[model samples]
Target chain A: MKNILIASTSTIHGSSYLEYILDDLATFFKDTEEILFIPYARPGGIFYDDYTKTAQKAFSKINVRVKGIHTFENPIEAIRNAKGIFTGGGNTFILINMLYKNNLVEVLREVVNNGTHYLGTSAGSNICGLTIRTTNDMPIIYPPSFDALKLVPFNINPHYLDPDINSKHMGETRETRIKEFHNFNTQPVIGLREGSWLHVKNDSILLKGKLSARVFEVEKAPYEVESGTELNGLK
Target chain B: MKNILIASTSTIHGSSYLEYILDDLATFFKDTEEILFIPYARPGGIFYDDYTKTAQKAFSKINVRVKGIHTFENPIEAIRNAKGIFTGGGNTFILINMLYKNNLVEVLREVVNNGTHYLGTSAGSNICGLTIRTTNDMPIIYPPSFDALKLVPFNINPHYLDPDINSKHMGETRETRIKEFHNFNTQPVIGLREGSWLHVKNDSILLKGKLSARVFEVEKAPYEVESGTELNGLK
Candidate 1:
């Protein structure tokens, strides 16, 4: 049985999302000993250490051996020996670049297909798409290249928001920029609002987060979708 | 007769594209008195001095007057005094960035609509699109930004070429990356191959330059198009 909890955040331990997934993790670890924690998105960022520490503390509370994969010089080996993989969020472009550079995208696909549980956060949730078009980053930075791990069918625009308080220093709104993307592309883009996430297992996607997410398709007005709704084209 | 020529090379007097447009320039300017050159793309580069030297040497042979617009910081004045505008190729991202930063996109649009004869090459050709999605540069390096002058109804990916050599050192193939773009967008993306140019006059797009250009649409296979075909989405 393949089980994957691709989350926007794992800390909902006391909330509905964390409650549901933590219960599942508790049950899964009843037999297994360790779960591999891959923190590839942060790369050299110092702040990501907090995300790693948080995951370590959370998993340790349940007697789960959570190992951080960043220390491994050979990431392929770390991925190979993993029973489960949890990707944290920071910069999806940076993460995807590293993954493509190391040729580990296929390896990751194999790991997911082999029934290894997969978990992801913001940027982590982004790599689960056909392309990183939905990303908030300006498109000029080519990274090493542009082949994202096509874990899902549509593009993921993480940290999605409606209108928020603007300080003027932030420049243009992301919504306007995303509309430009809609103007340029022919496929549907999923604007995954902060705290919202997609969970995939056995070809099923379950939405988890605070509220419904927005979907932007060309030639149509944007619409809101509920959690657990099967998105078009993903199947 | 709007003689709009889109050249593969910005300085056609010296460089060689598949189809030479320098000779055509002389024929086109026989009746015209002045030509306006937009060197915004090659900001801080030597286009103002270098390209003018090239054009001066060549145009003087035919007794034509050519001046680069680097002298006019105000685009309105530049557009008003010129018989035609010649847009040159450079770092397109940089060029569009400057245009957007200076709020000249609308100004240029108005100039073109006013029937000032217009010509463009490479980066200049790219700005004639609704978006700059097809560009190869990493979108974040913002010499100014990724925002573009939306003259055409679609995006332009210039310097477009097939991954002919399959070298590992380079990034993903342009086709694959654009397909990845299709996953998130519904708008048709025009991939103008190297040496290919689009000549637009009075709402008509006439393909010029080499043998053919490849265009990719969402959900459709890539197609080869020859000169004179109308671009689908351009208004």
Candidate 2:
């Protein structure tokens, strides 16, 4: 059975890192003593060690120890022996590139599928999708491929925002970009708002948190699904 | 000598398509009777014919005929013999992918370098940079590479937006994304606000329009450049 928490973001507005979801994380990782943190995303171009320390401080409040995968001699072994897994957010392209370069994609996916508690935030959650096509991040680096861990049947657009009605900027809105993605792809995309998350347990994936998620399908108009709605039958 | 007008957008907020830049275009494309339009970057998922027609309609106002590259059986030949060229905005990834797939990258670069009047909006303008790594569009398709025409020494972030001081969105700001790009690459980037453009005349590239553009350089704080400012010495 697959067990995962794919969150739209690690920190919500006006909150500390991972603070908003700490309670839920504490419950989800109750029996696990430590988490193998993948700080490959390196948010804000921060050093890997500093990024790992940030994750450690957050997990410490929940009485859980966090160990960065980079600290281990073998990342593959770290994933294999991890009681729980957590991947923090940053540039998605770099994260996926590093995952491929380190040959950790398959092992990470396998461990998570085998029922290890997995937590993904932002770029981390993006990899749970079929592809990273819908990411809002710049392609600072080209990954081996846009293919990501197929933890879920569909792709995800993290930190999805609604088009500002009063804004004058002419850049494509998040919704428009997803529509363009559907032009070349058929995979469904979940526009996950900052406060929302998908709780995946076995075959059931339920939308959690305070807000609704926008669901996009090919050749169809996008619609919103309220919190607590199950996404198992979405595709 | 290179004669090109790389615009941030085809249309500004509350203006008809190409209306704002039509006069400048008329002056730049003076003496040119027909323009070969590369509608590969179909904005908003519009068909090539429709997008071409839109360009045709806009250019008609300046008494210039527009022909989509798609209409020609020989795209490379058409580019080579073109009197002028225009590439509208859409998904940068797909546009660049098609350019490579059709083997037009080299020819287009060559023609533009040879002084065939060229106009680019949004995605089109992005390709004038060293790479399309700074584009804000979704990666709907993977290009052969992010390498672009290198018409200019630096990259461009079209439709550049300032960070909203009051907004609570957790996504990386435009400046932050550009900063991230600088972390891996040394190319300087110009954040061209809507209605702003870079007028490339031979070796001189000047910022044109009513708004100031932001300049981001590696290891240095980004600064603003006023309209009519010469970018010839930027690199």
Candidate 3:
């Protein structure tokens, strides 16, 4: 089976975003020696030895190879050589920038289609959507180029919501932002609130998270939904 | 001379958002009998009465009229005949809904052209843009179509910020969301941080309110901008 781990953070081996998927990751890569790491998403900023070290420590404990893609001068080579890919989150815009700058978006798409195991979180997860319209980051930072990998048909809005923070001072809330998105296009946007993820394996798509995801269809009211459901069915 | 008060709140009567603009509002419409309220931006919500009443009380001392547009069966006539217009804060999507529903978006645009003293706060201020993309609300529940008033070009991302809040549970921050928006569009979006409002009077467009606002341009980096600056120059 193709193994891809698109994680928000690198190590479910310790404190990581995919803690919910640790058992699944371990079970899938039990015989694997190394897991390729794509840190290209954070090309502009300095890595403070924060999550990278954490991911290294966790993967080392499990005898999984942890390779950062930065070492390779060419990003396409790094993606092409990987057995299974693990995408860690930083800035999706930055990630797409590096990917497009090196022209790796197409290669990555092809790799995934070739039945490579794909695992992603946060920024990594965002690339899986049709578009990146739902992201909550500043859109004009010129983080390389704003184009996404286009793995899925809709945009991904990661780290979806915080119920306690008063959205008044911060701007419009998440729900309001997406509704505005809907007004511009007829395509439906899948709003995956935090703690939730969509898992695409083989021909199946599964939804994993605490809260039910919200889906917005143009000219229709937004509604709560779950994963494992087909997006094609809704549109 | 045409008088306009673009505030962050309905009542300079109170609230931190009003402190800087209160005296100016009172002085601008010094001789006006009352301010016409446009609650149409917040259609079908339960908060209109309380919102409209607050402004009524604030202007009550000045004997200013605070009548909601919905009160008149023909809100267009009310707007066309008004001495001044004050748009209160509420869900922008809701407000946009009412604007589209009543076919009053054009009417309001015409009213502005007719030189009616206009005061729009929050949601009201949002409609001033070409598109209300800057609002910090949920995207799920759309009220109506949001074409905005076209008073200005470019989309606005209001109440923008980097993730200062350390809460892990709150999903992705606003920065992440707008970043997603950037990826989808070739046009640069303006990230108007809190305490910032833009004033459009005659040919002069001034960025009012606090310190400096952040500006995001497509395929470029986001930069900090100051008040009294015009948005037209950037586009």
Candidate 4:
């Protein structure tokens, strides 16, 4: 059986890194001893070792050891051998670019499908969908392709923010950017708000956080789905 | 002589499309009677003809007629023979993909180098830089390359918004995004606030409008450059 947790963000307001979701993670990784951490996203350009240490400290509470994928001689072998895998948030382009460079995209997919528990946050979570086109991150680097794991039927727009009516800024809101994506692509998109996540077990995917997620389909109105809602078969 | 106006956005918060810059445009386009409009970045998925009509309505106020480049049977030929050019904003990836698809990148650069007056807003303005890596728009479609016209020395982040102090969102801010870009790319970036623009003529590139732009260089602290500051030789 496949078990995964795809979170919108690693940290929320008034919370330390991964602090809010630590308890949930303890239960999620109860059977696992250690996890291989993919730190290629490097949020704010953090070094891989330092980022891994942060993960190690967080997962310590759950009695799970964390190791950086860069420490291994072969990343593909590492993923296959990992009891659990965690890809933390940063820049999606950088993460996807490194994934393609190391030829780990397929091996990681195969391992996850064969039942290695998986956890993804932010940029990490965005790759669990059909494409990274809906990501809010700036395209700092170009990957070989926009195609992703297709773990879900649609795309995930992580850190999805709602429009602030009182703001003076003129930039396109999150909804506007997604609608523009629908113009050229037919993939449905889920605006996964902060503190929200998708819990995938076997063939079922459920919204597992407190906040409601925004759902968007082509030529239709964008609506909200409450927590605990099933999100499989969105396409 | 490379006469160009690279604006951050088409519309500001209170203005109706192009109202704030009308007087300046009247002077900037004084020598041209007709201008070719590139509507490939169709904001909100608007049709080419309709987007062209919007440009037509705006330019009519300055006594300059607008024509959509799509209407021309030969795009390269139309670019070569144009009196002036205006590339409206929408999605940067869409604009660049279509530009590469039609093989107009070099031709547009050649004509602009030969002194064709050009105006670009948002996505259009983004292409004037070293690359589109700093663009705020979503990557709805993949382009052949992130490379752009290189009309300017650095990248331009249009619709550049400042960090909100009280917001609850956990996504990367514009500055955070640009800092991440600096980690992988060496090119400097200018965050052009809405209603601000860069006026390039011959060898001089000057920031114009009421607001200051944020400048970021690798390994250096980002600083604010006031309006009227020359931006050439920034790399």
Candidate 5:
């Protein structure tokens, strides 16, 4: 009963914004006329209007009109009547904080569960989990809670990178960080590399994009799930 | 008078834990025979006693004995009576969370400001900031607040690294994340590179080690400060 596109990143190396996934996006939103964009994440201090315009330009190629939820007088109502929704990438802390601040958290979830199409990239994708405990973004701001939409049973670690063997930096690797997260949390986590995503429809959650996503569970050796694998049973 | 050695990391590449800064630590802690180790930020799933033992091994080289606070019957009294204190690194959230959980945040700060000769590495150094907002660690656990010891006016982004120009990873770099942090917070932040530290004696905060540190202030271009530069003026 759900139509969601949870992408690891909106942009990748040597590619334009959403260019790599344009075809997939077109098919994902084919049934919709317009989609509401949540530009609260606003990567790199991008203004909300400017961010929305970028999204609009990208969606224009798909013949789907786009509008930022901020433009609405009643955003709750906008979510209620939206044909589809797209939450773009930025800072996860700021994005989730804004979601809770605007009181859009529950309403958006409710509408999406009722069959409103959804799209999330990067920070947006991270919010489609039970909690934001596995996010790779800095805690630039504190949200009211770490709890997320719970759209998926497990958490998402977007823009996931493998440990650089030659680098001498002492910072914890991406895998180590998620493993440390398992020390305090039990939820499964999917480390979604740049071009990967999860396409959830009803009870089926299919891995999209070309890269295999690293899946981590408590007290278990992490393994990779290929592009065509079903990730719905991860929990 | 304050005596503090706030290092960017406890371990560096190809070196034993605390090896890179042992001499500096010996000088910093020369006045004391024993140090109460705040092993709450146990990195890498190391148990409290085991972490204490590791700290003991490092400090033993300087003829100093280390004991974990968890072994104390009254941690508050231990903090008050201890001749010196060392808070090792692990995860900032867990370290700060346990500090708050044990009601030791204010007491530890009080004792340190009262000439407790405090030393902090990595996550420990992060907590000496105005808030734990600038730490590079993953938020595996939620603390009661991001508010930290405020031992200094500015925040510390320990284990700070420059953006990898060659990497195609789409994740936000360390500098970008801090800029985003400035969008919501006003405090100054010092990006302490590995092998770098801030040696505080009373009011003078001197940057120590082999490398320059990055200084970040709101709306200002982040610039490098040489190893010997005084960081007390950041605020």
Candidate 6:
């Protein structure tokens, strides 16, 4: 059975780093005293060690220890031995690239599927989808492939935003981008807005938090899925 | 001499298709009666023929005819003999993918460099830069490479928008995305707002339109470049 907490964002506006979701994280990662952190996402181009320290500081509040995957002699071995795994968010391109480069994609997926506790935020949550095609981040780096872990049956558009009706910006909205994704893909996409997340346990997935998630399927109108809605059928 | 009109978008907020830039295009492509349109970047998954028809309808108002590159027996020959070239906006990933698939990247760059009258809007304009790394579109498809025409010295962010001061969205802002690009790339980037364009002639490139464009360079503060300012120095 897979136990995962995938969040749209680690922090909300006017909140400290990982503050809003820390309580939930504590509950999801209860039995684990330490988490193996993958800091390759490197938000704002932050150094990996610095990013790890940041995560450590946040986890310390809940009396948990954080260790970076880079600190291990073998990342593959680290994933195999980790009590829990957490991937922070930044640039999805770089994160997925590193996952392939380090040859951890297979092992990471294996451990997560073998019932290891897993947590992903933003770019981290994105890789849990069928593909990274739905990501909103810039292509700052090119990965060998757009394929992800497929931990979830569908793709996730993290930090998804609704169109501003009053704005004059002509760029495609979140909904428009996903519709375009349907042009070349058949997988369903979940527009996971900030403050919302998906709780995946075994074969079941549930939308949690205060907001409703926007669900998009091929040739069908996008509709809202209320909080606590079971998403396994979407898979 | 290179003659190019690179626009941020084909249409403005309330205008008809290409209405805002049609007059400038008419003056820039003064001697040309027909344009070879590259419909590879099919906006909203529109078919090539349908997208070309849209362009034809818009160009007809200016007494010009539009021919899609796909209509030709050989797209390479079509580009080589084109009197004027226009590449419209769409998903940049798919556009670049088709450019590579058709082996048009090198030939297209050569013709445009050899003094062909050229016009690009949004995704089209983005390719005029060093790479498509700065594009805002979803990665609906993967290209063989992120390398582009290098027609200009830097990269371009089409339909560039400023950070919303009042919005609560947690996604990275336009400025932040560009800054992230600088982490892996040294090239400067021009954030071209809607209605703004770059008029490239020979060795000089001038910012043109009603609004100012934002210029971002590595290790320096981003600043606004007024319309009509010569951007050759930026190169």
Tens digit per residue, CA lDDT, model 4, B46-132: 499999988999999999999999989999999999999999998999999999999999999899989999999999999999899
User: In candidate 4 chain B, what residue range of length 10 has the lowest lDDT sum?
Assistant: B40-49
lDDT leader: 2
Writing each residue's lDDT as its tens digit, candidate 6 over B1-235 gives: 8999999999999999999988887898789999999999874334998999999999998889999998889999999999999999989998999999999999999999999999999999999999999999999787889999999999999999999888777889999999989888899999999999999999989999999999999999999999999999885
lDDT of each structure? 0.63, 0.93, 0.64, 0.92, 0.90, 0.92
Report iRMS values in order: 14.9, 1.5, 8.2, 1.5, 1.6, 1.4
lDDT at position B171, candidate 6: 88
| Model 3 alpha-carbon miss at residue B225, Å | 16
Candidate 2 stretches greater than 4 Å from native = A43-46, B43-46
In the range B122-227, model 2's lDDT, one tens digit per residue, is 9999999999999999988988899999999999999999999999999999999999898889989999999999999999999999999999999999999999
Provide the TM-score of chain A alone for each candidate, in the order shown.
Answer: 0.80, 0.98, 0.83, 0.97, 0.97, 0.97
Return the DockQ of model 3: 0.14
User: Looking at candidate 4, what is the lDDT of residue A123?
Assistant: 91
Model 1 regions lying over 4 Å from their true place: A1-235, B1-4, B11-19, B45-47, B55-63, B138-145, B232-235
What is the model-wide C-alpha lDDT for candidate 1?
A: 0.63
Q: What is candidate 3's CA lDDT for residue B119?
A: 82
Clash pairs for candidate 2: none
Over A1-76, each residue of candidate 6 has an lDDT whose tens digit, in order, gives: 9999989998899988889888888898889999999988874334888999889999999988999998888999
* Residue-level lDDT tens digits of model 1 in A1-235: 4455555444433343244356556765655567777666654555456657777776775677777776668888888888777787655666776787777888887777677777776667677776666665324223554446666666677666576453221223456555555544565667776556776667676676566888877777888999768664442
**Over all chains combined, what TM-score does candidate 3 have?**
0.58
lDDT of 1 at B66: 69
Error of 4 at A34 (Å): 0.6
What lDDT, from 0 to 1, does candidate 3 have?
0.64
Q: DockQ for each of the predicted structures, in order?
A: 0.04, 0.76, 0.14, 0.79, 0.70, 0.75
Q: Model 1, chain B: what is the TM-score? A: 0.81
* Model 5 C-alpha lDDT per residue in residues B1-235, reported as the tens digit of each score: 9888899999999999999999988888888899999988864334898999999998999999998899899988999999999999988899999999889999999999998999999999999999998888887888889899999999999999999898888898999999988988999999999999998889999999999999999989999999899877778
Q: What CAPRI class is candidate 6?
A: medium
**What is candidate 4's TM-score against the reference?**
0.98
